[model samples]
Target: MYDFEYVKPGSLDAAKSAIAGAEDGKLMAGGMTLIPTLKQRLASPSDVVDLGGLGDLAGIRKDGNSIVIGAMTRHAEVAASADVKAAIPALADLAEGIGDPQVRNRGTIGGSIANNDPAADYPAALVALGATVRTTKRELAAEDFFTGMFETALEDDEIITEVVFPTAEKAAYAKFPNPASRYAIVGVFVAKGGDGVKVAVTGAGPAVFRVAEMETALSGNFSADALQGISVSADDLNSDIHAGADYRAHLVGVMAQRAVKAAG
Candidate 1:
Protein backbone atom coordinates (compact mmCIF):
# COMPACT_ATOMS: atom_id res chain seq x y z
CA MET A 1 0.00 0.00 0.00
CA TYR A 2 1.14 3.49 -0.74
CA ASP A 3 2.17 5.69 2.20
CA PHE A 4 -0.53 8.06 3.59
CA GLU A 5 -1.37 9.85 6.82
CA TYR A 6 -4.14 8.40 8.96
CA VAL A 7 -6.51 10.45 11.12
CA LYS A 8 -9.08 9.01 13.52
CA PRO A 9 -11.35 11.81 14.62
CA GLY A 10 -13.30 11.57 17.87
CA SER A 11 -16.34 13.43 16.59
CA LEU A 12 -18.30 13.96 13.38
CA ASP A 13 -17.27 17.62 13.09
CA ALA A 14 -13.61 16.75 13.58
CA ALA A 15 -13.78 14.00 10.95
CA LYS A 16 -15.30 16.34 8.40
CA SER A 17 -12.77 19.04 9.14
CA ALA A 18 -9.84 16.65 8.85
CA ILE A 19 -11.03 15.41 5.46
CA ALA A 20 -11.84 18.91 4.20
CA GLY A 21 -8.32 20.12 4.90
CA ALA A 22 -6.58 17.30 3.04
CA GLU A 23 -5.75 17.68 -0.67
CA ASP A 24 -6.94 14.15 -1.39
CA GLY A 25 -8.87 12.64 1.48
CA LYS A 26 -10.78 9.38 1.79
CA LEU A 27 -12.96 8.33 4.69
CA MET A 28 -12.68 4.82 6.10
CA ALA A 29 -15.82 3.36 7.65
CA GLY A 30 -15.54 -0.43 7.83
CA GLY A 31 -12.53 -0.40 5.46
CA MET A 32 -13.82 -3.53 3.67
CA THR A 33 -13.35 -2.10 0.19
CA LEU A 34 -11.00 0.79 0.92
CA ILE A 35 -8.36 -1.33 2.63
CA PRO A 36 -8.14 -3.79 -0.28
CA THR A 37 -7.93 -0.92 -2.79
CA LEU A 38 -5.21 0.78 -0.80
CA LYS A 39 -3.22 -2.44 -0.51
CA GLN A 40 -3.34 -2.84 -4.28
CA ARG A 41 -2.08 0.73 -4.83
CA LEU A 42 -5.33 1.59 -6.66
CA ALA A 43 -6.03 4.55 -4.37
CA SER A 44 -3.38 6.89 -3.01
CA PRO A 45 -5.11 9.55 -0.99
CA SER A 46 -3.17 12.19 0.95
CA ASP A 47 -5.02 11.21 4.13
CA VAL A 48 -7.22 8.36 5.38
CA VAL A 49 -9.77 9.73 7.84
CA ASP A 50 -11.15 6.89 9.97
CA LEU A 51 -14.73 7.31 11.13
CA GLY A 52 -14.66 4.42 13.62
CA GLY A 53 -13.75 6.67 16.57
CA LEU A 54 -16.96 8.67 16.19
CA GLY A 55 -19.07 6.79 18.76
CA ASP A 56 -22.33 8.46 17.80
CA LEU A 57 -22.19 7.15 14.24
CA ALA A 58 -23.20 3.61 15.09
CA GLY A 59 -26.57 2.25 16.24
CA ILE A 60 -30.10 1.35 15.15
CA ARG A 61 -33.32 2.88 16.37
CA LYS A 62 -36.92 3.26 15.30
CA ASP A 63 -38.09 6.76 14.38
CA GLY A 64 -41.89 6.72 14.20
CA ASN A 65 -42.59 4.99 10.87
CA SER A 66 -38.95 4.71 9.98
CA ILE A 67 -35.85 2.88 11.18
CA VAL A 68 -32.87 5.19 11.60
CA ILE A 69 -29.45 3.54 11.37
CA GLY A 70 -26.22 5.36 12.07
CA ALA A 71 -23.58 5.37 9.32
CA MET A 72 -20.91 3.44 11.18
CA THR A 73 -23.31 0.66 12.17
CA ARG A 74 -21.91 -2.72 11.15
CA HIS A 75 -23.75 -5.37 9.13
CA ALA A 76 -23.83 -7.79 12.07
CA GLU A 77 -25.52 -5.18 14.26
CA VAL A 78 -28.22 -4.61 11.63
CA ALA A 79 -28.66 -8.35 11.13
CA ALA A 80 -28.99 -9.00 14.84
CA SER A 81 -31.00 -5.93 15.89
CA ALA A 82 -34.30 -6.73 17.53
CA ASP A 83 -35.81 -3.48 16.27
CA VAL A 84 -34.75 -4.17 12.67
CA LYS A 85 -36.04 -7.74 12.77
CA ALA A 86 -39.34 -6.66 14.27
CA ALA A 87 -39.90 -3.72 11.95
CA ILE A 88 -38.26 -5.02 8.76
CA PRO A 89 -37.36 -8.69 8.88
CA ALA A 90 -36.48 -8.72 5.21
CA LEU A 91 -33.85 -6.06 5.78
CA ALA A 92 -32.37 -8.07 8.63
CA ASP A 93 -32.35 -11.15 6.41
CA LEU A 94 -30.57 -9.19 3.69
CA ALA A 95 -27.93 -8.07 6.15
CA GLU A 96 -27.43 -11.59 7.41
CA GLY A 97 -26.75 -12.77 3.87
CA ILE A 98 -24.17 -10.05 3.08
CA GLY A 99 -20.74 -11.70 3.14
CA ASP A 100 -19.38 -14.34 5.50
CA PRO A 101 -19.17 -14.03 9.29
CA GLN A 102 -16.08 -11.83 9.08
CA VAL A 103 -17.43 -9.48 6.44
CA ARG A 104 -20.78 -9.21 8.16
CA ASN A 105 -19.04 -8.42 11.42
CA ARG A 106 -16.66 -5.80 9.96
CA GLY A 107 -18.54 -4.22 7.02
CA THR A 108 -20.62 -1.13 7.69
CA ILE A 109 -23.79 -0.19 5.79
CA GLY A 110 -22.55 3.38 5.23
CA GLY A 111 -19.32 2.11 3.73
CA SER A 112 -21.19 -0.37 1.52
CA ILE A 113 -23.56 2.23 0.08
CA ALA A 114 -20.89 4.93 -0.19
CA ASN A 115 -18.63 2.72 -2.27
CA ASN A 116 -21.69 1.81 -4.36
CA ASP A 117 -20.35 -1.43 -5.78
CA PRO A 118 -22.69 -2.66 -8.54
CA ALA A 119 -23.07 -6.03 -6.82
CA ALA A 120 -23.45 -4.66 -3.30
CA ASP A 121 -26.75 -5.58 -1.53
CA TYR A 122 -27.70 -2.46 0.49
CA PRO A 123 -28.53 -0.39 -2.62
CA ALA A 124 -31.36 -2.76 -3.53
CA ALA A 125 -33.00 -2.53 -0.09
CA LEU A 126 -32.51 1.23 0.02
CA VAL A 127 -34.12 1.78 -3.39
CA ALA A 128 -37.06 -0.56 -2.80
CA LEU A 129 -37.70 0.59 0.77
CA GLY A 130 -37.43 4.27 -0.22
CA ALA A 131 -34.67 4.99 2.28
CA THR A 132 -33.10 8.39 2.82
CA VAL A 133 -29.35 8.91 3.11
CA ARG A 134 -28.43 11.71 5.54
CA THR A 135 -24.96 13.11 5.08
CA THR A 136 -23.00 15.83 6.81
CA LYS A 137 -24.09 18.28 4.14
CA ARG A 138 -27.55 17.11 2.97
CA GLU A 139 -30.09 14.33 2.67
CA LEU A 140 -30.79 12.41 -0.55
CA ALA A 141 -33.09 9.62 -1.60
CA ALA A 142 -31.39 6.28 -2.10
CA GLU A 143 -32.21 6.28 -5.81
CA ASP A 144 -30.75 9.76 -6.18
CA PHE A 145 -27.71 8.99 -4.02
CA PHE A 146 -26.40 6.08 -6.09
CA THR A 147 -25.28 7.75 -9.32
CA GLY A 148 -23.56 4.79 -11.02
CA MET A 149 -21.18 1.88 -10.48
CA PHE A 150 -18.88 2.63 -7.56
CA GLU A 151 -20.21 6.21 -7.54
CA THR A 152 -22.51 8.30 -5.34
CA ALA A 153 -23.88 11.86 -5.10
CA LEU A 154 -21.84 12.62 -1.98
CA GLU A 155 -19.48 15.55 -2.13
CA ASP A 156 -15.78 14.95 -1.49
CA ASP A 157 -15.96 16.72 1.87
CA GLU A 158 -19.31 15.27 2.91
CA ILE A 159 -19.67 12.17 5.12
CA ILE A 160 -22.79 10.11 5.56
CA THR A 161 -24.22 10.42 9.09
CA GLU A 162 -27.16 8.08 8.98
CA VAL A 163 -29.77 6.35 6.79
CA VAL A 164 -33.49 6.62 7.37
CA PHE A 165 -35.57 3.73 6.03
CA PRO A 166 -39.35 3.87 6.04
CA THR A 167 -40.88 0.60 7.16
CA ALA A 168 -42.62 -1.10 4.27
CA GLU A 169 -46.02 -2.78 4.41
CA LYS A 170 -44.45 -5.81 2.77
CA ALA A 171 -40.86 -6.36 1.71
CA ALA A 172 -38.42 -9.16 0.84
CA TYR A 173 -35.10 -9.61 -0.96
CA ALA A 174 -33.72 -12.48 -3.08
CA LYS A 175 -30.41 -12.78 -4.89
CA PHE A 176 -28.28 -15.16 -6.91
CA PRO A 177 -25.04 -14.50 -5.10
CA ASN A 178 -21.54 -15.41 -6.18
CA PRO A 179 -20.59 -18.39 -4.05
CA ALA A 180 -17.06 -17.23 -3.42
CA SER A 181 -17.47 -13.58 -2.51
CA ARG A 182 -21.19 -13.69 -1.63
CA TYR A 183 -21.73 -10.57 -3.78
CA ALA A 184 -25.01 -10.52 -5.61
CA ILE A 185 -24.86 -11.68 -9.20
CA VAL A 186 -28.47 -10.56 -9.68
CA GLY A 187 -30.28 -9.42 -6.57
CA VAL A 188 -33.86 -8.16 -6.39
CA PHE A 189 -35.76 -6.34 -3.64
CA VAL A 190 -39.57 -6.15 -3.66
CA ALA A 191 -41.64 -3.88 -1.47
CA LYS A 192 -45.15 -2.50 -1.07
CA GLY A 193 -45.58 0.67 0.97
CA GLY A 194 -47.39 4.04 1.03
CA ASP A 195 -45.56 4.90 -2.18
CA GLY A 196 -46.86 1.77 -3.90
CA VAL A 197 -44.92 -1.24 -5.14
CA LYS A 198 -41.18 -1.03 -5.80
CA VAL A 199 -38.93 -3.64 -7.43
CA ALA A 200 -35.23 -2.82 -7.39
CA VAL A 201 -32.50 -4.90 -9.02
CA THR A 202 -28.76 -4.85 -8.34
CA GLY A 203 -25.67 -6.55 -9.86
CA ALA A 204 -27.25 -6.95 -13.27
CA GLY A 205 -26.25 -3.56 -14.69
CA PRO A 206 -23.84 -0.71 -14.13
CA ALA A 207 -25.90 0.25 -11.05
CA VAL A 208 -28.97 -0.64 -9.05
CA PHE A 209 -32.27 0.17 -10.83
CA ARG A 210 -36.00 -0.42 -10.51
CA VAL A 211 -38.26 -2.47 -12.72
CA ALA A 212 -41.32 -0.36 -13.49
CA GLU A 213 -43.32 -3.08 -15.25
CA MET A 214 -42.80 -5.53 -12.42
CA GLU A 215 -43.64 -2.82 -9.90
CA THR A 216 -46.87 -1.96 -11.71
CA ALA A 217 -47.88 -5.58 -11.91
CA LEU A 218 -47.04 -6.27 -8.27
CA SER A 219 -48.92 -3.13 -7.28
CA GLY A 220 -52.03 -4.64 -8.79
CA ASN A 221 -51.39 -8.14 -7.39
CA PHE A 222 -48.72 -8.69 -4.80
CA SER A 223 -47.69 -12.20 -5.81
CA ALA A 224 -45.01 -14.07 -7.71
CA ASP A 225 -47.59 -14.98 -10.36
CA ALA A 226 -48.01 -11.27 -11.13
CA LEU A 227 -44.55 -11.33 -12.76
CA GLN A 228 -45.36 -14.13 -15.21
CA GLY A 229 -44.63 -12.42 -18.53
CA ILE A 230 -42.30 -9.63 -17.41
CA SER A 231 -38.71 -9.73 -18.63
CA VAL A 232 -35.37 -7.94 -18.04
CA SER A 233 -33.45 -6.95 -21.14
CA ALA A 234 -29.76 -7.88 -21.28
CA ASP A 235 -28.86 -5.01 -23.59
CA ASP A 236 -27.23 -2.87 -20.91
CA LEU A 237 -26.16 -5.50 -18.36
CA ASN A 238 -22.73 -6.51 -17.14
CA SER A 239 -21.05 -9.62 -18.58
CA ASP A 240 -18.21 -11.20 -16.62
CA ILE A 241 -16.79 -14.67 -16.06
CA HIS A 242 -19.16 -15.37 -13.16
CA ALA A 243 -22.30 -14.72 -15.22
CA GLY A 244 -23.16 -13.41 -18.67
CA ALA A 245 -25.43 -10.47 -19.44
CA ASP A 246 -28.33 -12.65 -20.65
CA TYR A 247 -28.02 -14.95 -17.66
CA ARG A 248 -27.94 -12.03 -15.27
CA ALA A 249 -31.01 -10.56 -16.98
CA HIS A 250 -32.77 -13.87 -16.59
CA LEU A 251 -31.80 -14.01 -12.93
CA VAL A 252 -33.42 -10.61 -12.38
CA GLY A 253 -36.81 -11.99 -13.28
CA VAL A 254 -36.28 -15.17 -11.27
CA MET A 255 -34.98 -13.33 -8.24
CA ALA A 256 -37.81 -10.79 -8.46
CA GLN A 257 -40.31 -13.62 -8.41
CA ARG A 258 -38.60 -15.15 -5.40
CA ALA A 259 -38.60 -11.78 -3.66
CA VAL A 260 -42.28 -11.28 -4.34
CA LYS A 261 -43.12 -14.73 -3.05
CA ALA A 262 -40.98 -14.13 0.02
CA ALA A 263 -42.70 -10.82 0.60
CA GLY A 264 -46.07 -12.55 0.54
Candidate 2:
Protein backbone atom coordinates (compact mmCIF):
# COMPACT_ATOMS: atom_id res chain seq x y z
CA MET A 1 0.00 0.00 0.00
CA TYR A 2 1.17 3.51 -0.69
CA ASP A 3 2.26 5.45 2.37
CA PHE A 4 -0.66 7.54 3.63
CA GLU A 5 -2.01 9.08 6.80
CA TYR A 6 -4.81 7.13 8.43
CA VAL A 7 -7.60 8.82 10.38
CA LYS A 8 -10.26 7.02 12.36
CA PRO A 9 -12.56 9.73 13.55
CA GLY A 10 -14.84 9.17 16.50
CA SER A 11 -17.75 11.24 15.18
CA LEU A 12 -19.44 11.66 11.83
CA ASP A 13 -18.66 15.36 11.70
CA ALA A 14 -14.99 14.68 12.42
CA ALA A 15 -14.89 12.05 9.73
CA LYS A 16 -16.26 14.53 7.23
CA SER A 17 -13.74 17.12 8.30
CA ALA A 18 -10.88 14.66 8.04
CA ILE A 19 -11.75 13.82 4.47
CA ALA A 20 -12.58 17.40 3.45
CA GLY A 21 -9.23 18.62 4.75
CA ALA A 22 -7.11 16.11 2.88
CA GLU A 23 -5.91 16.78 -0.64
CA ASP A 24 -6.77 13.25 -1.74
CA GLY A 25 -9.03 11.54 0.72
CA LYS A 26 -10.80 8.18 0.69
CA LEU A 27 -13.31 6.90 3.21
CA MET A 28 -12.97 3.36 4.50
CA ALA A 29 -16.08 1.44 5.49
CA GLY A 30 -15.21 -2.09 6.59
CA GLY A 31 -12.32 -1.73 4.13
CA MET A 32 -13.37 -4.77 2.13
CA THR A 33 -12.62 -3.29 -1.31
CA LEU A 34 -10.55 -0.28 -0.32
CA ILE A 35 -7.96 -2.23 1.64
CA PRO A 36 -7.32 -4.66 -1.17
CA THR A 37 -7.08 -1.85 -3.71
CA LEU A 38 -4.65 0.05 -1.52
CA LYS A 39 -2.44 -3.01 -1.12
CA GLN A 40 -2.47 -3.58 -4.85
CA ARG A 41 -1.46 0.05 -5.42
CA LEU A 42 -4.60 0.71 -7.43
CA ALA A 43 -5.43 3.65 -5.14
CA SER A 44 -3.07 6.04 -3.40
CA PRO A 45 -5.09 8.57 -1.47
CA SER A 46 -3.15 10.95 0.74
CA ASP A 47 -5.47 10.17 3.64
CA VAL A 48 -7.64 7.19 4.51
CA VAL A 49 -10.49 8.09 6.86
CA ASP A 50 -11.90 5.05 8.57
CA LEU A 51 -15.61 5.31 9.38
CA GLY A 52 -15.69 2.25 11.66
CA GLY A 53 -15.59 4.30 14.87
CA LEU A 54 -18.87 6.07 14.11
CA GLY A 55 -21.13 3.85 16.14
CA ASP A 56 -24.35 5.66 15.26
CA LEU A 57 -23.82 4.76 11.64
CA ALA A 58 -24.60 1.09 12.12
CA GLY A 59 -27.93 -0.65 12.69
CA ILE A 60 -31.29 -1.60 11.17
CA ARG A 61 -34.64 -0.10 12.06
CA LYS A 62 -38.15 0.24 10.69
CA ASP A 63 -39.59 3.70 10.14
CA GLY A 64 -43.27 3.69 9.36
CA ASN A 65 -43.49 1.63 6.15
CA SER A 66 -39.83 1.81 5.33
CA ILE A 67 -36.73 -0.02 6.51
CA VAL A 68 -33.81 2.25 7.37
CA ILE A 69 -30.35 0.69 7.25
CA GLY A 70 -27.44 2.69 8.62
CA ALA A 71 -24.60 3.13 6.16
CA MET A 72 -21.92 1.58 8.33
CA THR A 73 -24.08 -1.46 9.07
CA ARG A 74 -22.19 -4.60 8.12
CA HIS A 75 -23.58 -7.15 5.66
CA ALA A 76 -23.77 -9.76 8.43
CA GLU A 77 -25.78 -7.41 10.62
CA VAL A 78 -28.36 -6.91 7.85
CA ALA A 79 -28.42 -10.63 7.20
CA ALA A 80 -29.06 -11.40 10.86
CA SER A 81 -31.27 -8.46 11.83
CA ALA A 82 -34.75 -9.44 12.98
CA ASP A 83 -36.25 -6.28 11.56
CA VAL A 84 -34.69 -6.87 8.14
CA LYS A 85 -35.70 -10.50 8.04
CA ALA A 86 -39.27 -9.79 9.07
CA ALA A 87 -39.72 -6.73 6.93
CA ILE A 88 -37.65 -7.57 3.84
CA PRO A 89 -36.65 -11.19 3.93
CA ALA A 90 -35.32 -11.01 0.39
CA LEU A 91 -32.90 -8.27 1.39
CA ALA A 92 -31.73 -10.40 4.28
CA ASP A 93 -31.30 -13.33 1.90
CA LEU A 94 -29.33 -11.16 -0.49
CA ALA A 95 -27.09 -9.97 2.33
CA GLU A 96 -26.58 -13.50 3.52
CA GLY A 97 -25.47 -14.54 0.05
CA ILE A 98 -22.84 -11.80 -0.30
CA GLY A 99 -19.33 -13.20 -0.55
CA ASP A 100 -18.21 -15.55 2.29
CA PRO A 101 -18.10 -15.24 6.07
CA GLN A 102 -15.20 -12.80 6.19
CA VAL A 103 -16.66 -10.49 3.53
CA ARG A 104 -20.11 -10.64 5.08
CA ASN A 105 -18.75 -9.73 8.52
CA ARG A 106 -16.61 -6.88 7.25
CA GLY A 107 -18.26 -5.33 4.18
CA THR A 108 -20.51 -2.34 4.83
CA ILE A 109 -23.64 -1.42 2.87
CA GLY A 110 -22.43 2.13 2.30
CA GLY A 111 -19.11 0.97 0.90
CA SER A 112 -20.69 -1.57 -1.40
CA ILE A 113 -23.13 0.92 -2.87
CA ALA A 114 -20.52 3.65 -3.03
CA ASN A 115 -18.02 1.47 -4.82
CA ASN A 116 -20.80 0.55 -7.25
CA ASP A 117 -18.99 -2.49 -8.54
CA PRO A 118 -20.72 -3.60 -11.73
CA ALA A 119 -21.20 -7.03 -10.18
CA ALA A 120 -22.17 -5.89 -6.66
CA ASP A 121 -25.51 -7.13 -5.26
CA TYR A 122 -26.81 -4.15 -3.28
CA PRO A 123 -27.35 -1.87 -6.28
CA ALA A 124 -29.97 -4.22 -7.65
CA ALA A 125 -31.79 -4.23 -4.33
CA LEU A 126 -31.73 -0.46 -4.02
CA VAL A 127 -33.01 0.17 -7.52
CA ALA A 128 -35.72 -2.47 -7.42
CA LEU A 129 -36.92 -1.53 -3.94
CA GLY A 130 -36.98 2.17 -4.88
CA ALA A 131 -34.76 2.95 -1.91
CA THR A 132 -33.64 6.43 -0.96
CA VAL A 133 -30.00 7.06 -0.17
CA ARG A 134 -29.55 9.52 2.67
CA THR A 135 -26.23 11.26 2.66
CA THR A 136 -24.57 13.91 4.83
CA LYS A 137 -25.32 16.48 2.18
CA ARG A 138 -28.72 15.40 0.91
CA GLU A 139 -31.03 12.56 -0.01
CA LEU A 140 -30.95 10.85 -3.42
CA ALA A 141 -33.10 8.27 -5.14
CA ALA A 142 -31.34 5.01 -5.87
CA GLU A 143 -31.69 5.50 -9.61
CA ASP A 144 -29.98 8.86 -9.30
CA PHE A 145 -27.38 7.68 -6.82
CA PHE A 146 -25.77 5.10 -9.08
CA THR A 147 -24.59 6.91 -12.21
CA GLY A 148 -22.27 4.49 -14.01
CA MET A 149 -19.64 1.80 -13.57
CA PHE A 150 -17.72 2.20 -10.31
CA GLU A 151 -19.36 5.62 -9.92
CA THR A 152 -22.04 7.46 -7.97
CA ALA A 153 -23.61 10.89 -7.66
CA LEU A 154 -22.00 11.60 -4.30
CA GLU A 155 -19.91 14.71 -4.05
CA ASP A 156 -16.40 14.85 -2.69
CA ASP A 157 -16.58 14.51 1.12
CA GLU A 158 -20.31 13.81 1.10
CA ILE A 159 -20.97 10.74 3.22
CA ILE A 160 -23.86 8.34 3.02
CA THR A 161 -25.74 8.25 6.33
CA GLU A 162 -28.36 5.60 5.69
CA VAL A 163 -30.60 3.97 3.11
CA VAL A 164 -34.37 3.99 3.43
CA PHE A 165 -36.26 1.26 1.59
CA PRO A 166 -40.02 1.25 1.34
CA THR A 167 -41.34 -2.13 2.41
CA ALA A 168 -42.45 -4.16 -0.58
CA GLU A 169 -45.38 -6.51 -0.82
CA LYS A 170 -42.97 -9.00 -2.32
CA ALA A 171 -39.33 -8.91 -3.40
CA ALA A 172 -36.49 -11.33 -4.13
CA TYR A 173 -33.02 -11.46 -5.67
CA ALA A 174 -31.37 -14.20 -7.75
CA LYS A 175 -27.89 -14.26 -9.23
CA PHE A 176 -25.43 -16.29 -11.25
CA PRO A 177 -22.35 -15.84 -9.09
CA ASN A 178 -18.72 -16.25 -10.07
CA PRO A 179 -17.90 -19.43 -8.15
CA ALA A 180 -14.72 -18.15 -6.55
CA SER A 181 -15.45 -14.46 -5.83
CA ARG A 182 -19.16 -14.98 -5.35
CA TYR A 183 -19.73 -11.70 -7.16
CA ALA A 184 -22.82 -11.76 -9.30
CA ILE A 185 -22.12 -12.38 -12.97
CA VAL A 186 -25.79 -11.64 -13.54
CA GLY A 187 -28.06 -10.78 -10.62
CA VAL A 188 -31.68 -9.68 -10.72
CA PHE A 189 -33.85 -8.19 -7.99
CA VAL A 190 -37.59 -8.26 -8.58
CA ALA A 191 -40.14 -6.39 -6.52
CA LYS A 192 -43.89 -5.84 -6.40
CA GLY A 193 -44.60 -2.93 -4.15
CA GLY A 194 -47.09 -0.08 -3.68
CA ASP A 195 -45.86 1.64 -6.83
CA GLY A 196 -46.08 -1.56 -8.87
CA VAL A 197 -43.61 -4.08 -10.23
CA LYS A 198 -39.91 -3.32 -10.61
CA VAL A 199 -37.16 -5.54 -12.01
CA ALA A 200 -33.62 -4.33 -11.46
CA VAL A 201 -30.63 -6.16 -12.92
CA THR A 202 -26.95 -6.13 -11.96
CA GLY A 203 -23.59 -7.72 -12.91
CA ALA A 204 -24.67 -7.86 -16.54
CA GLY A 205 -23.91 -4.36 -17.78
CA PRO A 206 -21.75 -1.36 -16.94
CA ALA A 207 -24.07 -0.74 -13.99
CA VAL A 208 -27.33 -1.85 -12.51
CA PHE A 209 -30.31 -1.26 -14.79
CA ARG A 210 -34.00 -2.07 -14.84
CA VAL A 211 -35.83 -4.34 -17.25
CA ALA A 212 -38.99 -2.48 -18.22
CA GLU A 213 -40.44 -5.32 -20.26
CA MET A 214 -40.10 -7.77 -17.41
CA GLU A 215 -41.51 -5.27 -14.96
CA THR A 216 -44.45 -4.63 -17.23
CA ALA A 217 -45.01 -8.33 -17.64
CA LEU A 218 -44.84 -9.04 -13.92
CA SER A 219 -47.15 -6.12 -13.25
CA GLY A 220 -49.81 -7.74 -15.36
CA ASN A 221 -49.14 -11.11 -13.80
CA PHE A 222 -46.81 -11.50 -10.84
CA SER A 223 -45.44 -14.91 -11.72
CA ALA A 224 -42.35 -16.46 -13.23
CA ASP A 225 -44.40 -17.58 -16.21
CA ALA A 226 -45.24 -13.94 -16.99
CA LEU A 227 -41.60 -13.40 -17.95
CA GLN A 228 -41.67 -16.07 -20.64
CA GLY A 229 -40.67 -13.81 -23.56
CA ILE A 230 -39.09 -10.81 -21.79
CA SER A 231 -35.32 -10.45 -22.08
CA VAL A 232 -32.73 -7.71 -22.02
CA SER A 233 -30.55 -7.18 -25.07
CA ALA A 234 -27.00 -8.56 -24.85
CA ASP A 235 -25.53 -5.71 -26.86
CA ASP A 236 -24.39 -3.63 -23.89
CA LEU A 237 -23.71 -6.31 -21.29
CA ASN A 238 -20.29 -7.18 -19.90
CA SER A 239 -18.49 -10.08 -21.52
CA ASP A 240 -15.52 -11.23 -19.48
CA ILE A 241 -13.71 -14.56 -19.44
CA HIS A 242 -16.21 -15.81 -16.84
CA ALA A 243 -19.24 -15.27 -19.09
CA GLY A 244 -20.22 -13.77 -22.39
CA ALA A 245 -22.73 -10.97 -22.95
CA ASP A 246 -25.19 -13.35 -24.57
CA TYR A 247 -24.90 -15.75 -21.62
CA ARG A 248 -25.33 -12.89 -19.17
CA ALA A 249 -28.39 -11.69 -21.08
CA HIS A 250 -29.75 -15.22 -20.90
CA LEU A 251 -29.09 -15.23 -17.14
CA VAL A 252 -30.97 -11.97 -16.73
CA GLY A 253 -34.14 -13.64 -17.94
CA VAL A 254 -33.49 -16.79 -15.94
CA MET A 255 -32.59 -14.91 -12.79
CA ALA A 256 -35.54 -12.56 -13.11
CA GLN A 257 -37.80 -15.58 -13.33
CA ARG A 258 -36.08 -17.12 -10.34
CA ALA A 259 -36.45 -13.87 -8.40
CA VAL A 260 -40.17 -13.67 -9.15
CA LYS A 261 -40.65 -17.26 -8.05
CA ALA A 262 -38.59 -16.64 -4.94
CA ALA A 263 -40.62 -13.55 -4.15
CA GLY A 264 -43.73 -15.63 -4.12
State the lDDT of candidate 2 residue by residue for 61-120, as single tens digits: 899999999999999999999999999999999999999989999999999999999999
Off by over 4 Å in 2: none
- Per-residue CA lDDT of model 1 for 1-264, tens digit only, reads 999999999999899899999999999999999999999999999999999898899999999999999999999999999999999999999999999989988899999999999999999999999999999999999999999989999999999999999999999999999999999999999999989999999999999999999999998889999899899899999999999999998999999999999988
TM-score of each: 0.99, 0.99
- State the lDDT at 196 in candidate 1: 98
- How far in Å is the alpha carbon of 50 misplaced in model 2? 0.3
Report the Cα lDDT for candidate 1: 0.96
Q: Which lDDT value does model 1 have at 76? A: 98
Cα deviation of 219, candidate 2, in Å: 0.6
User: After TM-score superposition, what is the CA distance of residue 27 in candidate 2 from its true location, in Å?
Assistant: 0.4
Least accurate 10 contiguous residues by lDDT in model 2: 227-236
- Segments in model 1 whose C-alpha atoms lie over 4 Å from true places: none
